[model samples]
Target chain A: MAAPESGDGNNGAARMVTLISSDNTRFEVEAAAASLSQTLQLTILDGGGGGGDGIPLPNVDSATLSKVLEYCIKHAPAAANGGAPNATAVDRAELERFDNEFVNIDQSVLYSLIMAAHNLEIEGLQSLVAKKVADMIKGKSPMEIRRTLGFPDPTPEEQAEMNAHMLEYGWAYE
Target chain B: MSGTIGVTLEQSRSRTAGPVLPENHVVSEILVRLSAKALLRCRAVCHSWHRRTSEAAFLLVHHRRQPSLPLVTFLAAASSSQSQHSHASLDTLDLRLPPLIGVGWTPLPRLADAALYLHGSSGECHILRCKRRRYGDHGLTTNAPAYHVLTIGSSAEPRRIELASNAPRASTWWFRCSERPGILLHGCLHWALHSSPEKLLMVFDTVTESFRSMPSPITGTQERTQLLEMDNTLAISWMDMCETTMRLWLLQDYETGVWTLSRRIIFPVTEMRSVLNVKWCRFYGTVVSQERYVLLHDSHSSYLFHCDGEGKLVRKFCWSGAVPRPAGHIGSQRASSGMSSSEGNMVLVRGDNHVSFKASRV
Candidate 1:
């Protein structure tokens, strides 16, 4: 699929891009938004294939693909708008609020986001997802945390072993 | 075939979708970063994760990432010179390990007064008193005060022991020391001893069964020794003889030769009566914790002293003393000495103000 490029005919602004997902889906995103992914941008630029073929992203599904695009779109504007001429506190506050809302999804979706961000080399998004998952289990008990993480049940002997290990190695004596 | 396909699509649509990341990898990654408290919680969630995290190897790995360094203390009979002895000649216990749990403590080997040194993986402790016998006019003045050492690891076994000093007469003992009443500080056992000459502080290593002398945190300033252990840090409180002013000092890590001067806590000294003669003046004891150290004064008054990562005192609480103290405190009747244990948050012992108690940190 051919990605559409919208820019004034200028030497420095002419850039092309392509994207693909794990399920054989292709996305023809603008170079501006596609460039948000350093991995994809570097790959395309290195290949020197301008306005040619779709970018192959063999890991992301369409649902996650759209979400990544939304983030790229939101972030691209700020980068293109001269870094918001000193981002206002309100603007930062709004961004924080949006990020919180964005991560409010179920753990399954969050896991997908982590994978997509990692595969796409979106460091900021990947860290956000990892931190969010960490925060979710911060205060939870081992059992609740295990259940939340969908861990299997331990056998009686294994439980004993764990308890013994904690007794032997744990530093709770402080 | 078309009807079957439609039914299959409907069934797939109705199923609830869970996150797509492989459960094993994600679970392991988070478990690696969880704190002790959080990990404890995670243990209860399910059997599989609990088993995985409860392994000594896994917990050790986690501990390596974030270790818990505790300050062990001890209590013993004080000597006449007002100085503590080394635990180099006594048995030792190894209290140091990879971080595994929170606030849990393990007792090191305990030794008697006449031992050499104690060394352990966590740290080393030594007896701080010397046998002093004055012989002149009155037959023989046997004024040698007694003291002991409680170390972190078992020193009875053959291990490369580290001695605190490069003194020429470095000796080693084989007998295992009895576990006395005191606290563990920085993995070494600490105790207090009282005698006619003066008070003494005792520390011992459990691993190498060696010992060394612990110098006063307040080196130059002459202060009545009153020690406490908060969290894994040591809080040594004293009153300068010259000014009768109170002060607190912290030993960050004796193994690393780190001694930090904590905030100075001054008490009012009146001229009507000798400040040193006050029996109840030494009733406050402090116990260090993760963020704040609890100070028990007059066997009732509880104050909190906050500390930073460097073990520097940062803040204090001004809550009034609690009524009818939770613990009993009795001073010696005659030239009786008072003692305070920083390990278990024991209240200050009135009367004899020289002897310090080393309670277990757990």
Candidate 2:
């Protein structure tokens, strides 16, 4: 499908594309925004996702796809500017604030977002979510981390091994 | 919390029940963002985390991802009047914390009898200390230097490594082991030895705990030079005392020891005079942060200049009269010298004075 030139004439109209999520939810977004995902960039560049067929994302659910698109749309302009060397300080700060707020979601949503971002090959989203997870893991003990990550109670043998490790690395606890 | 002690928590309680565990690659990504100490603590999380974190591949990835904050460890005499007894201390200017007030100075346990001097540290925070054997009433029976490597907070005792017989010995006052910190790269720590008529690079492989020497990139130059690690490769930077020119050479091929002259920078006469009023001064340069900036400090003065790779001045900082100098120390001879860390942080060590500057990108 050939992308129809935007009618604005100066820079052409913003080209829009349709993305179909796994659960059959359809999200219409700007082509530039959807192209932020390296996986989708190729298909979009090949003139896919421009028509009624819409690009299908089998690995990502509707909710996760929407969340990922929100990030791509917010970051697309800066990405298009080749890292936005000319971006104003306010512009950069706004994006940073947007990013921090974007990841402030439940752990379950964050996990799905991480998986979707990875499958879609969205570099910024992957890094943001990974850092969030790291923050949650920092400072917590192994048992706390196990609980936070939702691990089952340790078996007696596993508990014995953990106790031995704690004895060996007692300084870390201090 | 007591009621929950023996209860088996189901996966559904976890905020996300998609999978019991994240993929190994995802876990590695998260692990890389953690600090070294935090990562060590995480080793007890599970057997899988322990095995993954211990892999050499994961270490390299973590080193690359984490910012290299320059930390300075030095020995300070117990008192200004008494130079005999000293204690070791470490301080780091962590930028992740708030500016100016984030200095962490921890006094390390004192080494018994012998004076311990900091030689260098690896990116993994493995510190190498040289125990200078002091002669008492017994008189000098053995003068060989003793070396030890230990990580901070590690329960394992520091292990001593025997220096090879062929290792260059410091014989003269002027040629005391180069004040520069060891350059850690490629699983080895490298130090430049200033031997008369020839300067040799001494390398210690952290893996094998063996010592070997390699020829300096530029030989037979009377100019002062320092060895530094840049972009995972060994680099040497030297200043021409006669002229205001600095030459940087990088060992492009470690296996072949082939050095390519990467950059030749000429300092402006005015900028040079601002740092040093004298006509001739010894300056040592180290490439900081992806070869973008080179940090140069005058041997005799506390003034430090941060310049671009091309030798243009970006900014200048001076410790000047405020820096506590050991009494009777002559010339611009500093007890310790400054080194650039992986992320462009400048670490300056002299006697008890340890200062680190967060890299200001120009």
lDDT of every predicted structure (CA atoms): 0.44, 0.59
Indicate which candidate wins on TM-score.
Answer: 2
lDDT of 1 by residue, B1-362 (tens): 01111112111222334332344444555576665556655564555555677554464445444432222222222331443322211001121222212322223222222222223453342332222335556575544232334332234422333444531122221111221224444545554432212233455544544455555454221114444555456656554554334466677776664667766644332321232244344333333233333223332223322333333444433322112111111101111112223444221122111112122221
What local lDDT does model 1 show for residue B86?
Answer: 20
For candidate 2, write residues A57-157 as lDDT tens digits. 88788888889998988888888777789999999999999999999988778877877887788999999999998998888888878777766667677
RMSD of each: 14.5, 10.7
lDDT tens per residue, model 2, B1-362: 11112323232334445334354467788888886657767777877777778764575466455443332222222332443322222212221233322233333233222111123343343445565555546564545456676543345677787766776663321212223445656666666664345556777776676678777776433235656666667777777765467787899888877889988888664667755777665565544445445556554454545677777987655442321111111011111233223333323332233222222211
Q: Give the TM-score of candidate 1.
A: 0.44
Instruction: Summing lDDT over every window of 10 consecutive residues in candidate 2 chain B, give the lowest-scoring window.
Output: B324-333
Docking class of 2: acceptable
Kindly report which residue stretches of model 1 are placed more than 4 angstroms away from their true locations once superposed. Answer: A1-17, A26-55, A69-92, A120-123, A138-147, A150-174, B1-21, B44-158, B164-300, B305-362
After superposition, the stretches of candidate 2 with alpha carbons farther than 4 Å from their true spots are A1-11, B1-24, B76-91, B94-191, B199-225, B230-362
* True-structure lDDT of candidate 1: 0.44
